[model samples]
Target: MSTPFDLAATDELLSTTRAVRKRLDLERPVDVEVLLECIDLAQQAPTGGNRQGWRFVVVTDAEQRQLIADTYRRVSQSYFASRAATPTDDQTGRVRSSSDYLRDNLERVPAMVIPCQQGRPESLPLAAMASYFGSIIPATWSMMLALRARGLGSVYTTLHLVDDGEQVVAEALGIPDGWTQTALIPVAYTIGTDFKPAKRPPVTQIVGVDGW
Candidate 1:
């Protein structure tokens, strides 16, 4: 039997869709239509009860991007300070460096996307919270995959949504109440598209049979 899709290409796409940072081409401009196309594809993802309440707030205005970037940096300062004070392995250190770079250059990215859902999960039960997030996460990931397929790179960052930062960004972006922002994704073309699959533990080491 043959596969319905190109297995090799599918595997490559799945494996190589990395969380890009630092390598984002800041000088290149990304078309708004491309983002709209990716969002259209992402809308195909399943939503709770098919409500499809996901909303994407894209920031391309210089002032708005600057505000978001400033908010993110202000929130990340303490985090990066703590990480700098602690000991970390080489891989963790490298990740921190790249994240810092992204934090510093966030405003310069071609675009910023805030993936939002219609309901607030503030005091929802565990299951309800899961359902709430489950609705948006898949769509956001689909958008990321779509971005990768179209030669764009994006990194999912949530630092700006911490504590009062979410409200600050919301007010800045004029997002009405009752909606929760899931993540801030900075989108741009990649400097090069030669990303390789990251190293990971063997599947057997992480997977449980029927129970953990």
Candidate 2:
């Protein structure tokens, strides 16, 4: 079978698109046009019923970024404390360390993107809630892939959306009611683009053939 695209490059892009944290170059500025281009590409992702309701609120202002970062740090304190009380594997511990670093330096990142959906999922049925989130998550992932392809690095964090943190951020960003902020992504150029695939279990261990 003849493939129209370069499989090696395509596979490399997919495999190496990592959840960047400590390696994010905080001093480098990501261009607004590049972000817009990524969002444009992200919009091509599939949406429920073809209702594309994704809204990306990008925060580049220092003041706003600080406010959001503060909220994230405050909310993360309890989470970090909880994790500290429990035992974790080496990989999880490393992830927590990088998450701590990111929490401390989030405000310094070049840009923060809050991917949002148009509707609220509160009190909805499980299926409805899944449908609501299903619409936006794919687009957000697409945006991350696009960012990685452009030499930009990002990690999706949801700490700020905990409890009252969402309302506080909504007020800060002037995001109106009914819009659910899915995840907060810090965007910046990477120190280098030599990312490799992370370790994972074989497909046989994780995948279920028709049934678990």
Candidate 3:
């Protein structure tokens, strides 16, 4: 069967959509309309049972951005600190350094995207747990791909979900009761559109044929 889409272009876009951090352009402002358009495209991604339970909070207000950044840093400081203490390979060490850079400059990024779901899943039954979160995560990744196609950068950060940090962020954003915050994504125009595919272990090492 012949596919109508351009395979090369699709492959390039999928492979190059990276978790951008230090390369995010902090000085420029992100137009909310563009983000909305991306979200529109993101909403098309398939959801488990088509439950469609995703919600997004876009933070562009400086004070609100600062508040979220502070909450994130309060949790991330200990996380990155512990990672820094342990020895790591060159690639891992670079990631640690870039993570620290992102933590320091998270407030400056023009937009903060918080993805949410309809309800708490922590104590739910196994199937319920899978369905609830399964509905939103793909949409979030779709949003990232949409952003990348538009020359924007974003990093998915969940450090702030630790302990009471999520509650603090929800209060700051005025997120109503019963919604569960999934992740905070920092977004902005990228410094350049030259991202390459990241290194990974060979497929044979990571996959199994029909069984683990």
Candidate 4:
């Protein structure tokens, strides 16, 4: 059967949405309307039990952005110190380079997106933990895809959550007590939207037929 949609464009959008960092245009102002539109699209993503618990806190204020950036920087020092000592393959090396660049210039990025869920996964049972976070992660990814489609770029960052940083950021942002942050995303317009699909190992090596 033939499908009505443009599969090539769909695949292109899916494949080319890179974890953009260094190429992010830090100086460009991301319009609030566009960001909201993307989130509106994201809200259509399926949620666990249809709780619809996703919430996004968009930080565009200079002082708040700096504070969030500072918190991230403080948490990353030891991480980078250890990462520097570890050996990396070609792909890992590029990621590390971009991560370092983002870390240094995080404050200058125009908007920071903090995605939150309704409840804390840490205290939930294993199954519930999965269910709790399963609700928001897809919507977050959808948000990224929508951003890419609109000539914007973002990177998912959980580095700050390593050292009570989430609590600090929540306090800084005045987030309510019950909600838990899932990730920190830096959002900006890309310097260019010419991202190509990333290289990966052949599917045959990773995929199994009916069973592994």
Residue 63 Cα positional deviation in candidate 4, in Å, after optimal superposition: 0.4
> What lDDT tens digits, residue by residue, belong to model 2 across residues 1-212?
59999999889999999889999999988889999999999999998789998889998999999999999988778888888899889889889899989999999998989999998889889988888899999999999999999999999889998778999999999999999999999999999999999899998999999899
Distance from true location, Cα of 6 in model 2, Å? 0.9
Q: Which stretches of candidate 3 lie over 4 Å from their true place?
A: none
Off by over 4 Å in 4: none
Clashing pairs in 3: none
CA-lDDT, candidates in order: 0.92, 0.92, 0.90, 0.92
Clashing pairs in 4: none
After aligning candidate 3 to the native by TM-score, how far in Å is the CA of 205 from where it should be?
1.9
| lDDT for each residue of candidate 4 in 11-51, tens digit (9 for 90 to 100) | 99998999999999988998989989999999999998899
Least accurate stretch of 10 residues (summed lDDT) in model 1? Answer: 74-83
Clashes of 2: 0
Please give each candidate's TM-score: 0.97, 0.98, 0.96, 0.97
